[model samples]
Target: MTAALSPSESELRETLAQVLPAVRADLEDLVRIPSVYADPARAADVQRSAEAVARLLREAGFAQVDVVSEGGAPAVIAHHPAPPGAPTVLLYAHHDVQPTGDVTAWTSPPFEPTERGERLYARGAADDKAGIAAHLAAFRAHGGAPPVGVTVFVEGEEESGSPSLTRLLHTYRDRLAADAIVIADSANWDVGVPALTVSLRGLADCVVEVRTLGHAVHSGLWGGVAPDALTTLCRLLATLHHPDGSVAVAGLPQGEAADLDYPEERVRAESSLLDGVQQLGTGSVVSRLWNGPAIAVIGIDAPTVAASSNTLVPVARAKVSLRVPPGTDAHAALAALTEHLRSHVGWGAQVTVTGGETGQPCAIDASGPAYDAARSSFRDAWDGTEPVDMGMGGSIPFIAEFVDAFPDAAVLVTGVEDPDTRAHGVDEGLHLAEFERVCLAETLLLARLARG
Candidate 1:
């Protein structure tokens, strides 16, 4: 049950309303710069976004700000000392975004921030840019000097698997140490409701090559006798899943049942599934998405229909991504995936699987004082709606690193996106009302922690 809001809470909400316009404007400016870390051409733009975040931190009265890099992508680190006897908190977000694919699919330019009704649309608007803006809003609400100390750590290469994260964390461990940490890279339960991500699925990926033919031959001449590499590769990929779309890979750990019922209608609406398409797997939507193992062929090296000639290809390659639920070892899961692909190539096709990035799944224990404060603050910010503990299907590789680095600190996963935010999709957006609530919640959380 939610308790009544205190007098200070009422004042913070009013302050947030007054400062929201400026915060939204900051988000728009940051979104305008295309900061995609995956593309080498946009590397400078990613640095620009980091500089912009550093400026915002300085403007918000952060005592010390630095743009730190170690031969990879740069990160913005800023610190604000605690008001006597207050605990220090660490805030995490990323400045980089995913590459915009086929911009013609978007209603407006992907980098141009567009506002439609209660949503703000842009490439990075919801994913972590909104997160950066929320941190600024919380700091601005308290006149740039909160009751507790604050450390702002804005990463620059999160979308590209964060290859430099371990090095940066180790180098800056002393500066980033805090009593509590809040990762603003997750999604809310819904528009007006809040959620704390208590568990996250781990990730593993590989590129598999299949060679069925020694050389290309005319389809009309050898189609009947020779098996093309593309066809052979497709058959091998199909063996990873059952006819019902559930993962059929043997020796994988099964996921636990979800406490929340994710309705089919909501999933269809959010995922934008095609008409007449059936939902995959035989379980609740949350269970399949957040807990069970999922496999997808992210990319394939096959000729397009328009550019294809009627010839048997010699080799085909595919990029596969696998998501494992909490309590599963990521390295072991990758081994299982490699073994499954190697044994499933039909007709004695030669197969080679090479593993890529991997991160272990994480489950947070939300029973500490920091968590209690966050729950109370969220309830107050959402007007008596208690926050729910939810599981996320996506992997934040750095979350596990943060857990290992700061074992004593409570890590709270919060965000500004909702069900319809469509992060990393054609038209990514931020729900304006929910964003404001997120800002208010974080501000109140800081206040609550300071009281202790």
Candidate 2:
């Protein structure tokens, strides 16, 4: 679908252009708050951020705004009723951000919003914080009252696995209900390009411990015959993938072909892969990343080399994360992973696998009136550039819940992050131009939906 810039569209663009500076300032203010939900010490900061979000929603003309907290974390809920027969759109974002690790590695402070060149750099700059800003900007552009009804749902515990989300959903089902949902917590296709995330891989994690000897022994005395737990764990982890890096786990389904071609050079640059290092798995880059299962050793409990002695360690543990493609049950994948780890320990070593969080994959049907409006709105916002149907390798566990809760609603997963955004890492940033386009797209989408 293509966009024709009618007089109304031009007026909306002008309004957004005039309000862009204030929106950016609001984003800067939000980035200044260190709302890290994963850190227990920052619980107050998370609540503070939620209050800020609630204030923003109220200032943006939401009549009913409340901070809902159910023992875990807070969420900002606001509603702007529709005019006549317009559809209600539930806009979702998160106020809490990922923990900023290794402050020395960052070019600037993670909580201090700084602008260099054409980007804004901070911890939550390109993540869901930008998502919140985008929604506010769009709402402001419409003079604080859009044609369509809007429900602003700004979550506060998304970075911490959203343990309270199910309870929140159940308690406030009618308040959060809508005909369409927009999750602004995903990635764009690239800078200056838009994408609709159609599929997302599910996530499963487990912590596996391997035990060999009862106690540490001298390496020289036991090196020839005794097996170390660390060595055994490493060998077992190696069996999770083939030499070509394809997943060796059974019962996991492969993903479908991606709609766009992800170039190797682009992937290397985006991923910051070292020179001469080969990419993992087979098939296209998108297919390997989004269409197939991937295993990652997230953390390991082993003695550091600096503190290590000439001794054989008795116990070792590793945290493993598995990404399952759409259509695969995450719980089943977790079971398979546990079974594989338990049965693969060599030298009769005892192995124990404990399951962690499991999230289901999501696949959306992007062929409906809502999707058509989104495509056209994006085309207009991006200067005639068409939005692509993309898939995200990472999992957003709450998307599945939102889909289940509002089965008939059109779920549009959009975001402000680009290939170089570096979200959840050091020197995270947001492309200013792309963020403006995102606001414009959302504003135009509301207009289109209202017209229909």
Candidate 3:
């Protein structure tokens, strides 16, 4: 927690409001660069994004700011020493974003951020560029040189699996230490409703291929006898859930969040489910999404609707995604999911399951001194939006690193992106109004922490 020394609300406003425009401008500049990991063509753009953030930290009165390279993308570190006795707080946000798969679907160009309806339409705007810019707004507003000791960890490769963060933590744990960590990578519960992400669902990815015959047999020749790979794969996938649309996995337990915070109506609206298509999952919204396990067949290697070839597929493969409940061992879940697929063989079809890296989920301790100051700050930042509680379906593997390193640290995840923001999807955007409100909220957190 920050130390005590009162500053008037008017004073805080005077400090924060003046520089907001430039802060937003910087965010726009950040969104222009596409920072997809492993794309050699866009490596320079990611580096530029890294350098831009380092400059922001230096301007924020961090005497020491440098880009620490940890393999994939560089980690931006900025240090500000507090006046004696004040504690250190580490603010975390990512600099990179996912690849803009197709640009034609967007209303505006994906890289060229557009402003019209008080929202900035771009790739990184809501995801993390805005969140990273929010941290700068906080420190630059209250005191360019923060009253409390500060360490800013602006990571790259977050859109990727965050494979580099574990290495970064091990290599530079000393500099990353802080009493509490403020993670600005999550979204608000809804527009104008600020929410801290206390828990996140973990992830396990795999590629499953089912091989039936040696070649694509003509349907006319072997319609009845030919064992179809696609059909077999679908059958194995069908066993994942029961008739009630609940996961039927033998060991993975099922239950709802105690709060039952997210209502079904809200989830339906936010997810934009087709009106005619019935909801597939069972249990409460929180239970199905947050606590229980989910298996989604993301992509399939098969004939397209337009380019259909009337033949039996010799081999069928699917990129499958398995989301585990918070605190579930990812490898354990992966093994179970793999075994389930292998055991459900139909017509003596052979199935091969290959595993990929798994990202662990995080549940932060929000019952401490930091949470108290943050609740007050959130209220002050967003004109009394009455922030609700919500959990995310995605995972940030590095959040686990911080929790493990500083078990006692109050890890709070809040950001400008809201439920409908569409972070990793097509036509992604950020509300400019909410962006500044998040900045104000962050500003208040820093000021309240400084005055503690």
Measured against the true structure, the TM-scores of the candidates, in listed sequence, are: 0.96, 0.98, 0.94
The CA-based lDDT of model 1 is what?
Answer: 0.91
lDDT of 3 by residue, 1-452 (tens): 22222466557677778888888888888888888765778888889889989988887789899998878797799988877988888999999998887788888898888886878888988888888889888888877866788889999888877887888888888898888799999888777678888888888889989999988879888978888898888888888888877776666666467465666678678879777767767667776776778888899997777986889888889988888888688888888888988898689998999998787877766786788888877776666556656777777777877788878778888887877788888878888878877887787787677666
Model 1, 126-156: lDDT tens digits are 9889999999999999888889999999999
| Stretches of model 1 off by over 4 angstroms after superposition | 1-3, 220-224
Taking all chains together, the TM-score of candidate 1 against the true structure is 0.96
Pairs of residues at least 3 apart in sequence or in different chains that clash in candidate 1: none
Clash count list over all predictions? 0, 0, 5
Quantify how close model 1 is to the true structure by its C-alpha RMSD in Å: 1.8
TM-score of 3: 0.94
- Distance from true position, residue 29, model 1, in Å? 1.7
